[model samples]
Target: SGAAPRVDPRLLAEGIEASRRAAGAQASRLSPTAAPRQVPNEPVHQDGLRGLVERYWDNPLQLERVLIGQVQPGPLSPTEQAQLGRLLVEKHLSADRGRTLSRIGDEQRNYPNLARALGRSFQAGALTDGHLGYLLGPQGLGTSSRRGFEYTGIATLVAASGSPALQSTTATRSWELGAKQTERHAAVDFHTAAMRATGGSTEATQVLLQQAGPALIAAVDAVADLSRRAPVHPYTNRFSTALGTLLTGLSHLPSSQATNPVGARIVGHLSEQHLTAPALRKGFFDYLRSARTSRSWRGLGPASGNAFTQQELLTRFKDPAIRNHIVTEQYYRMSQALEELLPGQASWATFAVWASRQAGSAIRGEPLAGASGTNANGVRAISHGNTLGASEIAPLFGAFAQTLRSNPDASFQEVWRAAGAPNKPLLREAFQNYFEAYQLRRSGGGADAIAERVLVANTLVAQHEQTALQADIDSAMRVQGVSMWSLELDIPGRVLDLNEDLTGQFPPELRYLRNPRARQLEQQFGGWGDSRMESLFNLFRLNQRDAALHGDWVV
Candidate 1:
């Protein structure tokens, strides 16, 4: 024999404990007092290693504290720390698999300590590409019955580690794995893999883009081709969704710097060939329109049989819920990409036109209470329009304004240039009108004007139903609740009696002549005074106050 084989005592001890753990038995027969105490808020030590590894593998916070030296454990060798780090990464990958990778990546971004620890272990020989691949892979979270892939986590890790080998391996494995999946799933995988490839160091990201960019574009094209081949298939719907996701990812990639030549080239290709393509735009809208019709109204039972088409279902049932959801999601994604890439006239015009249509639909559907009962047609129309306006239009306009504010340095000329220099005056005018409208809406005056209109409408309604309105007001006044300053302020008995009497009138109005001393007292000590009473007094005194002030009521 060349030499007598020997095993270290520490290795033997560790192996025995590991075996005991594997067999679901106690690692040692040490007495309770002799056993190490695992105190709370203490640094993990070698004594706590087993429990730490077993219990804290999935607990990112605790694991992070230990790795970052926040928790003072008794003692751990470098090797032991590395082992723990490796174990944590492995467990996280296992726990995180099949879930949306982007979400997992977002979570990882928040836990830099964990990433640092994993990176350290990776630098050492403790973790390999296989371990990283699993951690950074497109494997998603789900049971054998249902599985899903996520790429965000992998992207985050690749970015954090800045490892060329890991990036390359993740890219290759993602493509291979996705190729075996359905077209929609594969598209998702490819998109996420592309995102991950574009992460990491400048050199690494460049290398990945050069290697993986063409493949990603080709994959996207293939999905589009498949959609064309089977336009009516349900899979085409999924493909459309995937394409939206893919375009979103591509549009959001980091802008190129001097060091990122490959990224610039890749972005240029995507921008020219895919993002700005008329075909892609048409595809997105067409898919969304088709999706509206494809929804199944299974809940309607027999009634659904007659409404086989989406339009037929809508016409029969007058339900806009499905349409609203589908349209909002699809249009929101498209608008987001447009704002990011185009960012001016074209994007604003698209949103404005869509919003106008939505508003028109809503106005046409405005409900009217009828003599027979509730007008179902009016109710349905109003409900549909309101849903679209509230969910989609408002958010789109808000986002447009926010995008402009956030990119103040991006001038009209720049935006026009970026948008391929479309009709300048038309764009300039659109920008001006949009900003003016946005400013007006943001000012409190718009809300006040709407409130005034509503008040007038309510007054007209009350005029027609005087008796009913009086009775409602009388009932409400009787149930008057205590105010925030109930203990400090008390209403005079005569004032309460007067208010009760006023409530019985069709349009109750009360006014108090200006008493400087009383007014001063009210202003100084009436923090929780009755708002309705104040409003009534103000309304009655409005003309007098305006005449005295030489304008509208001052306060």
Candidate 2:
């Protein structure tokens, strides 16, 4: 081998010492030295590593070359060797596969395959292995989509596309991936320089819109180019195709267009570029007209049912009112503002006012008497730590209320039973409370009296519900061969009619029921003359006829 270049060991020591001294001095100034606290052990920051690489290599493409030049592949020192194994394993199989990709190249301090393998093996052996093993072992190798996408593509599509937000969010994630490759702060500086050129508020918006429109159009075009180049990346191609359609649509809108003033005299004034001027003219007028005439501002704004999601449009503006009035309120608020744009209308001024009333009846939800279904006692009891315990009573109340609304003649017993009948003790306890309230109303007057009267009405309603329930039961039993009595009952109406001697007297209108022949006719098929109904009718109807035909002492 050629004679190695001679190096002064003392000079190398001095250079290292110099850096140590500098770092120590800076650390002393920046941080107060305190007792060491236990912290998670992590590798040196990638940022620091990258900075060192950039300082030495200067070119990103020359990472491997620079790394190879700086460090020879050999066994690492004790401490370095301990961490080397971990580094290898991390690079090959981190949960986020891209982390390894990010760390590769000149910045990584290129080592030979043997050295890399040793480091990785050490990491695989020394680490806790729980999470790491999950990534590398057979346990995680399954083909389930939740596992490893073992299922068919059709299943994945159905699962993924069910939620609309998830789709948009996934597409928007391209911004994050693209941001990693560029210096964003540098781009902002460029934007700032352009903003300073445009001297007015309106001019700034116009310029921004103009630039964004074309940039977006170009981005969409680039995506189309990518789709053609890489046909296999279907997901990316789909997203790109959608974005292209959106960008194209936005480019044609009025807001994207720019304008310059007719006559310019000022040295630094911005160009006249108010995109909203025309739309605002009609919108403002409509808003003002509706506010003056309409009792409710019902049709003043855009309908809520429109297909477009409003989040993107809202985010584009700073002021909430600008979003609400311009983008959301249709042409109502904007038209009036435009009508005043002329010379004489320049004197016009409008201001929003905020005020409140003492008794704000205008707000819809204020509790009104008889409107709130809950009673005063129920409300009071609710405040006290009392559980409503109205499960039994509520159904009963519902049945009664339903019947009262539909049928006035329904009895209370039927409704009560259907409501899940509570025992007599419970009813007695309820009545006690009712009677106490009734006495209180007798002592107190006005609304109290009326409320007491409602208590009585409630009892009657509940009683009617009970009666209807009994009639329903009787009618059902009669059909099922459980009841012997011959009485025709109307379940809903809570009315009962006599069909025979055992069922008491028939009413004048029901006298037609007295004829046994007529009863047979009434019971069967269409009329009442069916065989089954006639058999039932004979039991009731024949008795009435026999009593009518027989004379005293066989005269």
Candidate 3:
């Protein structure tokens, strides 16, 4: 405290009166209106997009104007169109941007267009599915009188009606729009046109069968042409009958084998389509179940009478043609699963050990138990591996392989290409391998049930594959140090693909669920509700409470 005080002694006030008088004199000379200079906010360099973005990002109206201007510039090229989407997003979203932004703009400037266009195509001259008009038709009147169909909404509707590729997508889109504000009569008209045009696709046909609402009138006549093709639609008196319209449609679609329930073999690259029988079955049955119990069809009036007896439903379900689809679909799933259970490029040698075990199990007639307690169905459950060798089965498999030599997949196909052909023992056993694959959690394949399930599904196996089969057998048998091989596809199927297909079709709301590859819902959700959100979710699944009361197949 004393240190500064020493220098601050009042003795240093050399000019107390002099400074006060001098400062007062100086202040008297200065003006009271003096102000500091100001500078404008102009960038040192020329402003481009980045500068503009940095300048006015805080202002919403100005940003919108910039965005509108960007969209202008006399229509962007297809390549530019794609880059602009990400570029615009980046300019607006300031937070998630940095080096990546610059790289996207610079590195990918010339990349192909990735953003798909979602609308009618001028190149294809495509229209909406069925040009749906309002169903303002009066009750108890001819449908035509009540239907408010019109081609007058837009110049495109009339033009589109004539030049179009019949697809159900637009109609489906309109149905999905359901009263959304942006969708207008144009959407309805487009849907009608699209619906009217589709005769080649099952998707379109199913859309027609299930279609309702204002646009349905427009599709009604188009669907009328399909009346003789699908009998259970528009006027089926029962819920099951109406639902079976899909089967009828499948039966009539061009190139569909009349004997098989499935149409066109769902040939595509979707992994989900190839595997997960349970998920597929669950999805199928769940859809049927929802439709069966729906109080109203498409939210129209009350659903058609469910007056059909349980036995009647069962009878329809058990129809050979219907069951054929069920069985074949199961087999398809089984083949896919078995193929997956095999190996990828991995040599057959890798699978021989497991194959031997399965062969032993098959030979002894003692089914091995799996995680599902007493799961003895073996390959039928996709739980156990398919065995390739045994005293009784090897000879027959060789014979079966002989038949499949010419098939490219070498995988079993579900169609019955040869009718009235003499049955080979291999046909029976091979079919038995997949027959019970679709049964509810396989319902525990009893000896008698197993015997009954060995129904025939002969298509791919034939004389040509004999050499390939023998070669494959020799390759794996060499690995086992004895005779053994996998009775699976030479190629491995992708399980991810199966799960993908199973979940891909889910509504947007369900897209987030953990993709479970269960062959049965019980396998996936069986032990849920004990903890996690399950207990809370149980409240919403009250409908499933009665699951135990019905037969597993029915459930």
lDDT of each: 0.38, 0.27, 0.27
Model 2, span 195-247: residue lDDT tens: 21121123232433444443433333343343344333323223222322232
Ranking by lDDT: 1, 2, 3
RMSD of each candidate? Answer: 17.8, 29.6, 25.8
Greater-lDDT candidate between 1 and 2:
1
**Candidate 2: Cα lDDT at 75:** 21
The per-residue C-alpha lDDT of model 2 at residue 395 equals 34
lDDT of 1 by residue, 337-433 (tens): 3334332212322322233233233334432121122233433433454343334233333344445556745554444344344343433343433
Error of 3 at 265 (Å): 22
Whole-model lDDT for model 2 versus the true structure?
Answer: 0.27
Worst 10 residues of 2 by lDDT: 346-355
* Model 1 segments more than 4 A misplaced: 1-50, 74-81, 92-104, 133-149, 162-165, 179-184, 219-555
Q: How high is the lDDT of residue 87 in model 3?
A: 33
CA shift of 72, model 2, Å: 32
lDDT tens per residue, model 3, 140-237: 11122211122111111212222222234433443454334243433343333333323223555556435543344333333223323333322221
In terms of lDDT, which candidate is stronger, 1 or 3? Answer: 1
Best by lDDT: 1
